[model samples]
Target: MTVTPDIVLVLCVLLVVIILFIIDRVRVDVVGIIVMVGLPLLGLVTPQQAVSGLSSNAVVSIIAVIIIGAGLDRTGVMNRLARLILRFAGKRESRITAMVSGTVAVISGFMQNIGAAALFMPAARRIASQTGIPVAHILLPMAYCAIIGGTLTLVGSSPLILLNDLLVVQGKSYEHFGMFSMTPIGIMLIIAALIYFYLLGKKILPGCKQIRERGPLSPLLDKTYHEVGKIYEMVIPENGFTKKSLGQLRIRANYACTVLAAYNHVTHKRIVAPLSEDELSPGDCLAVVGPPMFVEKLARDFGWIYKDELKVFADDLAPANAGIMEGIVTPRSALIGKRVGDFQFRRKYGVSPLAIFMGHEITVSDLSVQTVSEGNALLLHGKWSAFHRLKDQNDLVFTEPIRGEEIREDKATAALTCLAISLFMILVLNIQLSIALFFGALCMVLSGVLSIDEAYLSVDWMTVFLLAGLIPLGLAFENTGAAKLIADSLMHMLGVPSPIVLLASIALLTSFFTLFTSNVGATVLLVPLSMNLALSCGCDPRAAAMTVALAASNTFVLPTHQVNALIMRPAGLRPIDYLKAGAGMTIIFLIVLVAGMRIFF
Candidate 1:
């Protein structure tokens, strides 16, 4: 049969999702909302049905889980966990590779994989810096692990939620997957990942072996003898304080300074906890700890030069036109594919690249020397006017990029508590899952885990609005007989009478679609087709729907398919790194999923 108005409308919606995914003109959530509401308005579905998708327990559960993940992140729990991992990682490449992959997998199973990667990227970078391991060696494995972990349960990702909803609507009753159902498969993937890393992962990852050599510990660490107070570095001028003893100069009494370390330029030897009565020589660099005002005054009065290289006293600068600006690198920005060193950013903008807070960790060195990637955050330090000017440049990507301060201890705690409540609500309390999530979100505010403002920030309102908007279109696909028509066409193509073949066909198509589009969008497009195919083949539609849902979550081939791609740059990964590690795992999971469905369904 020819395509109907309803079918045409559905195609148009799919086109929009694809276009947005390719060009990234708007947030994915915004696109989702447009398809959802616009389809119903075009007489595709009723208003009530359109709005009902927002109430899906699966959506609520996923959102609540994000809040919980955020809380765990804020309390320094994830960082603490990462630090522990690094301690055990030692210098062995094999051991470090395995632990990093295992950690990402475990965390991704419980929380959002994207969030898990974001939390660990900085820690991973720090560990790489300390241990002399190539960051590219660890990052791709971490991203793949998160993707694998998400496959373990229905609540692990958005695609799973869409799958669960599609199955429920298909009239087949299936248990919501356990929190760890996919763990067995996930573990197998981890083993495979370890093997890949040991063999090819180390060799193909970009960046010099010299980059893996351990560097000296941060200068600040070596300079500070005490941790309780602030430390400042001031250079003693030849005439200002030459040949004066600490007591003679009354440096402590005059400037409220406590000497932490004294560096002799001639000898290059650092004296930690220098003696109070020690004579200050010309050109001596002293590390002093005290209040900001006192430190600044001491520098000004003593004619001491200020050093920015030492973070110990870097924060004590005279606030030289300093302010924070947040921006996201657009796909089209000059930084899209350049390395940090390629740009010589410091010399160009007079701004030092501080810490990049992205879905991955782009370090100061990377920003200074390596090529830049899209969606990466560049934390700039310079005069406020310079920052404002740089921000206004066209080739730069600047939008609602999240600030570092947003991810704090309280928000992290709130996110964790919300997860706990969501777990109780989903597995134990047996209350309506959506209500449970809403309550959990409420607790984030009430219990001081997150302020009202912060709680609002934590919510991905675009996703919420998009899901709410898309739900009606999905319903319309079912109600308008479009689903049945598509199913019949697919069944005729398969030309096999077996339900198993039809199920596999549906799944394969969904997985293939997911490689290029949003997993949620893939599910919305194919769920109706799968249901129709199931009915035509005289099988339970829920079984077929579940297969497609599971397949949609299996995005291991391309970094662009999920949030995993965003981590590639910081990890210093090459394209082959993903293909080598992800290709094999994708095949394994696809096989396992088909076999599992045949037995379980």
Candidate 2:
């Protein structure tokens, strides 16, 4: 194949994309947008072809899958799954690892792997706290399984979903893969990962002695605030205490105690950071944080029953549900140049201040009237839901990882029904994958499983645009003969190798490439070339394309994959930890992948 000017231009663009991705300074999405516009300007692809990726089936399917996952999450499906896993797992560390990691792998077979990993993170931490197991042992296996789980279905991951679309673009002879076309391979891989972790995990995985103590309140806070960060539960006296607002009682002003959460027995509702004017009724339970002596004194004076353990609000106040976060006052914050109480910090934001760290001084007393300034770091205590809402605002720049959302248990059945219908459409009706998935997402919005706004927020636009923008680049590679040229050069370099050797080479190359760039990027760049290489060697081009997509998920040797990065800091994992554990996983994945392709396809 002759390399034309267009091929040179495409190669140049491909090289720039690789370098920009490696440097990691520019946002990956921005790199995508640059390609989207740059290609049309350079005359390699027509303007229409450049914009066509946005309307591609792969992009639409990803958006729909994300929305459906969000609807499930909003309605408490994942939470219920977590509870069931814990119930069956018991206190056995090995059982907990297998159960949790296996479940996440199955969940990830349909939705984005990162989302599945993230949804299970708090649950993993909770398990560690309860079982005295270091989180590192659980997280590495879970992350690896989540990545490999993408091979379970066509829509399980972006690379797999894009495979059929890329094949369709390759020409009409290549047919699309069914939803479960890759199921056998995915199951084998997941089982291999589970068994690997079960036998060798304790020896290979990193150890964090402080992981158990690093619950929601965190060991850092316990060391920094000492008694002030100690949490206690209090019950209002049934007959002696009258219905009085918190402000009237001056709980913070007099006793320096902050009510972090309140549970109303009458309404059966839980409120976090209740306003000062919110009345405290008899027999209500309060989750408070303060100095031990002061809390004890306040409890004695009010004839309240106080317990050191958070038994009543234990689940609700667990690290997974609620926790303390540090928020720095931004220069643009409305709280700047005013006292903390001026905005009714607790009432408006649903968060109560625990301490203020300004410069080198830390103050925990009289926080309500404390003057806020730019760069002042305020330690706030509240539910994770409140922090999730505040994360979008510019008032405070949260320094900690914020996760978890409030669940709508009432809509769980509706969400499950939508998912079931979507599956039925795909399996029974033989409808288009994009149309069927989007139909389910629409049903979710209509059924109140998720609001329209929530559905929109659920999508990771970065992943969508990255896949969409790169589609045309793949098209250009084929159009300009760039892919065929590279294929010829590779074949010439190997001097007409056998089909199996060629396949292994292709898989290994794709796996290595994915470690640096996004898996989506690796898939788009390699599929066309691999298909061309396969055709030249008289091998099945579809099998070669499948190898590219599957191999892209074999990114275990590094923490570049989104799932690995998400669990790294929380699990206290280092690069060496990944290297030691992932080395074995990567090898196992390749062996299973090559053998499965030869056997199944």
Name the best candidate (by TM-score): 2
Q: Which stretches of candidate 1 lie over 4 Å from their true place?
A: 25-29, 48-63, 90-101, 104-147, 150-419, 460-473, 497-504, 510-549, 555-588, 595-601
Candidate 2 error regions (>4 Å): 86-100, 107-147, 150-188, 192-229, 232-314, 323-406, 492-503, 509-588, 595-601
Q: Which ten residues in a row have the lowest lDDT in candidate 1?
A: 312-321
Q: TM-scores across all candidates?
A: 0.51, 0.58
Error of 1 at 366 (Å): 35
lDDT by residue (tens digit), candidate 1, 69-148: 44554555555555577567666767877788777777776656665665566556645654567776677777777776
Using alpha carbons, what is the TM-score of model 2?
Answer: 0.58
lDDT of each: 0.59, 0.79
Model 2, 288-341: lDDT tens digits are 888889999999999999987665676567666678888889989988999888
